[model samples]
Target: MKNRVDFIDWLKAVGMFLIVLGHYFGEPFDQFTQPIYPKQLGVAFFVFVMGWGLASETRPQWQVVYNRLFPMYFWGVVIAIFISLIFMLTKGHPAITNYLPFIGGINVLGNFFPSNPTTWYIGTYLHIILLWALVMRKVNVTLPLILLVLFCEIAIRSIFIEFERLFTGYMLVSNWITVFMLGMYMHQQKDNHNNLKALLIMVLWALLLFTWASLLNPLNITQTFPFRLPVEHSTLISSLVVSVAISTVYLSNTLLAVKFFSGIPANPVVRFFSRNTIFIFIGHMPLYDVAEPIALIFVESGWGKRAIIVFIMYVGLAVVSELLHKAVNIDKLKKHLWLRLN
Candidate 1:
């Protein structure tokens, strides 16, 4: 359990860090060819690790999942409101007071929201965890669970078992859930000296991902639209790569990354985001909106220049978010306000 916590914690740091990096590197340069998607690993890893964590922590008692997940998501909603208000004010729009589905989109980051596309993962995550207990209650072990998931995915791919109308929400479990099961399987198989086996698995997964990533969309063989059939090969590749990354961290014995970063306390790369990691994720868009357009204002700016500016903007946003988070600890504030209201 302690190792699990350590491995998961580090995985979270690495996974989320990649997400930030992915965003900074989201778009490819026009002059030079790049991967179909650069920022995907961050998001895919986030989900895959969530699966790994969920599987190990709640193999039996899934009730705890709700207890852990809801507060964060509820706070995610509150943060969205904060962002929406700021956006409205900045854009000179009227105060957003009336209730609407937009809020649903915001709360979970977008299966319903329109602000940004990637946020849908948050909502999907919240919804899936709620149903996970029931799902796991009926399903069996992690390997079998993974197999069932693959069958479900293949059917979805071949158009055998269609649910086009049942639940359009991104939260409805699909391929994402399968990777989650994969995470659990990885976790369950983890043993003190099983590093070789883990490395072998990781290598195999990586090769599969590399092959898929190199081919998908570039060939345009399938319609890889969002929320549609024929899942993007990029997405599959990203998911697999993320799973390998998570598995690698646990399978490796050396704390090389931690040690290397820990040594460079003053290094800009290491220290720049040391504090503002989590908060920045919630509030980055407003900064990005302003920063990206401004970068465009320079008529001669290239993608390389734009990329550099975005990186700087992400850092600045991180700094600002950390400060905002410092100004208010939502959980504590909520408790205090509730006490007074009560």
Candidate 2:
């Protein structure tokens, strides 16, 4: 069995790239890829990949939790504090209320949601991992079982729309349960040589549904509002759309295992992007605070100028990521924290 799957790495790199570009597309870049970047799709692909990775670990151990889960929380807090400082400096008072969502108060009342929109992903990811830690200790992590859990949550939400919509909107453990499980299933079948037929079926099914949904309503392709944020959720249509998108990426990589993508998992560039996905994800939003203002100056400067801005943003961020990787060394710090805290 292969230790590293290049296609998975490729998919991760592509997904993170889309995510950053999606967040970056506000002023100057919005026109370049309006209603096409599929931000939710990138996030969904990431969650699915996470689930795939978690599939092998039936018993959620402390070391894995400390290593894998702590970074998001660590960065989430760091970002939250950073934002708080900004708020104080700019607004004359550090508004702790604004940062409430970071502590699981995003959409508790069914209407009040993430004021700091970027915080939802990391916060919800933490909740999902914590739940898995507690529950997977007693039960097995499998596709059917996860599907049942998803169905039950869906049913409950249907019954108590207001309550579920309010609470589950932010604490999204149950909302995306199905997609996460599907990711685990993907991991389970990683070595399937017969995946070509299944991949074709998934592609066809995805296309058919997308076309059908688009013909009836094109908005379906781009409309994902999980937790009242402009992010993807675990709705039936969304689940299918994201699942197919991820599968397509994986299958495409597998089928076309040559040229640039060949041995890509080991390639330094691909490895950097794939491994630093969380860093890119967390850092990009803040970087946008700076990049957006600069890009806006060149908003009307034509495509060539806009293209340069995009390239600079990508390269600058990549450099920062590399620097951050070398400077603080997040993994080592997390391990250190775990040692001290434990």
Candidate 3:
């Protein structure tokens, strides 16, 4: 087997692009495209990849957490402080609290700095990593464990609802943990594929896609679907179902990609996006805000306009992210910090 998987990089690039493109959509465009391409599916891809990549990790738990999270936390603080200063100068009131590390999610600064709300994934991702390192990694991949995790996730959400203290990051953890575990399961079972199993998995995946679409109904195509749950419970169940469904679809696609495309040489562009995903993911939103007005001046509101704007924002972010990636050298910084901590 090859030491590296090129298809995984391609998938990450695709996921990052989908997320950025999703954020660019507004109003009619979002409404039009959401049913066909839910942005949350991009997140599912990342979480799944995370699980697969880390399945065989042998590093100490704290070391793994530090290696994964510290660079993000470092850059997050820097960006948060910079944005806060900008707010001070422009809006004349900065959210001082945003300067603290992980005060909000380490990725987007916090709710106060809403420029990149998509960074909510940072907190959720961090929690998932912590959980996996501390607990999930120790367990054997089995049906019972998967089902138990799912049950615990649902139970946690139900309790959160009961208490009315719904932490978004924790809730998202509950939402995506199963997908993460499924990733681990996939890694474990990568060599066990057969025609019958593949066919069954595909069939189940199709059913999930249908169920997810019915639940989301982004187009409002049909308000009344059979087997709909009661109103109060519907929202919770719907979110979980949609997450699982979308994630499973991506999982199936991942299997196909690995099977067919893993040997292909990596595209430079896709590899760039994959490697710098976190940077671009965090930076794209703020850059989009700056690019949108200028882009709108050149085109009227429509699908064409949205595409143009997204393209401009994507290119601009790529340039900025490339520069930052070269200048900062996160790996070096992480090493320096690790030494100091030790």
Candidate 4:
């Protein structure tokens, strides 16, 4: 199946590009730029891709779904462990709160609930995956799922707020459902309705969404006190953005200005990307920090060098992640690397 959709691989390429870009802090356009918030902003794109991927797996055999997910997540644990171990030994264990925020992220309970800060994504991801398998499974995904999650959380906010709680889970639920369903809807349409006119509607919304997201961030609408609003900041806007991006990719089946971005997965580039996508994802964070000091050196000497550094960091991540997955023979890796409880 890796030979199936090159378009996704191209999207993976785009997502991977953003991963490195996110780490960088682009300067204020002095012939070179490094932006600190790109990653946070760029994250919705990747997360949306994840939802789209899930949506594609409509009623996939249980065995197949389990097989695909387990190895990737298990390796994430291994990488995170090595990361923590290295930091602990070298940095003298850092602060407890700083080093470990989510759970150990090893076994089911830890991974399901999450603790270590870096692995927060694990819990959040698992949260959605569980929903995908259960509550949202084989269901016709429409706007209601997103609205239900958001409004339910909104209703509970006053009570939860006193516990110093917030509605983060709702954000994930709302965003993934809308985006993933859109992706699934696209996959369904791909069989019979790949049309340029369809792509046009998607393009219009895509541009509109980008503008909305950019504007809200500038306004910091989500940053105010009481920290809770009737409608959350950027949640609705991001949902629209993610949905349209999914639509654009699915409809036109084209990547903008990038040949490598076209086709089914079998193309060596897509296969390489789809196969080791998780590895590159889990490994990039630690590796990206290492790149920053190096980027600084180039930034100080020549602004043009900053882009080069970001490029190097991205390529280096792909290479290293590919090598590591190869080393593990991930295809034959253990089932349930995480200890699960009944």
Give the candidate number with the greatest TM-score: 3
Q: For residues 1-342, what per-residue lDDT tens digits would candidate 2 score against the true structure? A: 337766567667777776655654534422222222345456656667676676667443666666666777676677667777887787776646435545653433334444355556765676666655666534556657865766655554443333335344324555556656666666654433345555665566556546533543423333223322114444545433443333333333323332233333346787777876766666565555576567667675565545545555566666776787688878778768877987
> Each prediction's TM-score against the native?
0.61, 0.70, 0.74, 0.63
lDDT of each: 0.46, 0.55, 0.62, 0.47
2 versus 3: better lDDT goes to: 3
User: Can you give the lDDT of residue 294 in candidate 4?
Assistant: 77
Candidate 4 local distance difference test against the native? 0.47
Answer with 1 or 3, whichever has the higher TM-score.
3
lDDT of 3 at 115: 49
Worst 10-residue lDDT window, candidate 1 = 29-38
In candidate 2, clashing pairs total 1
- For candidate 4, the TM-score is 0.63
Quick one: best lDDT, which candidate?
Answer: 3
Q: Each candidate: RMSD to true structure? A: 7.9, 6.7, 5.7, 7.5
Badly placed stretches (over 4 Å) of model 2 are 24-37, 58-60, 95-115, 141-143, 157-171, 191-213, 218-266, 301-315
Expressed as tens digits, the lDDT of each residue in 52-148 for candidate 3 is 8778788887888888887677766676677778778888877454443375445322223244455566677687888888888887887788778
Name the TM-score of candidate 3: 0.74
